[model samples]
Target: MDNTKLNDSDPYSIRGSHPILRGQWITLEFSIIIKTYYTDSTKVEYRDLENQRIQNIQGLEDILNSEEIQDSEKINVFTNRLATLKNRLDVLEDLLKTFYLDTSFLDHVKKVRKEIVNEKG
Candidate 1:
């Protein structure tokens, strides 16, 4: 929320999604905790232009939702602009759903949502 803007040039990725498996020594059952973020470098290629745009829109949404930005003098202006961007991204996502087949893209979107909600930027 300072004068610095969020980094958008390089891909943003979640870095904590490795699964942890837990099992009772006496039992044959195990539970796996799947973290929301993924650290794999190979997955970056799966984010197409639409997916990148959605991630950017979500970043704006994150900025607007931040407590630090709440008292800025230009709050209303930013809120409106970010809201418009969110709506457009939502519509575009709806249209692109059928066209997005690879699971990696979906994973990328989910990671973005989680990171934005957690205020990573």
Candidate 2:
């Protein structure tokens, strides 16, 4: 009576049936998960972008303070670029809300998994 949990090394593990219906459901759920994952990942990327933008603005301020490169034109250009980056950061903040909404997408995943399990049994 060998009672061992399923392991990767086991060749005869019951990985379950490959029914088309089940496969399709699983695929759909997996796709949703991936989409949600990507959305969440993008939020992190946006945060990093925001941090980089702040750093850039700080550096520009430092440069403006120094007597070197005291050209008004160059300072104006940097200010305009900083404004653009700030606008982009605002857009990314909105996208973060959308990414949070994506979390509700998991309800469908749970429902699908339940249906598959019930049908298989």
RMSD of each: 18.1, 17.1
Regions more than 4 Å wrong, model 2: 1-55, 101-121
What global local distance difference test value does model 1 have? 0.42
Kindly report which residue stretches of model 1 are placed more than 4 angstroms away from their true locations once superposed: 1-74
Best by lDDT: 2
Q: What lDDT is reached at residue 28 by model 2?
A: 45
For candidate 1, write residues 1-83 as lDDT tens digits.
52223332223312222222111211111000011123331122223344533224445555777776756666777777767
Report backbone clashes per prediction: 0, 0
For candidate 1, the 10 contiguous residues with the lowest summed lDDT are 25-34
Relative to the true structure, candidate 2 has a C-alpha RMSD (angstroms) of: 17.1
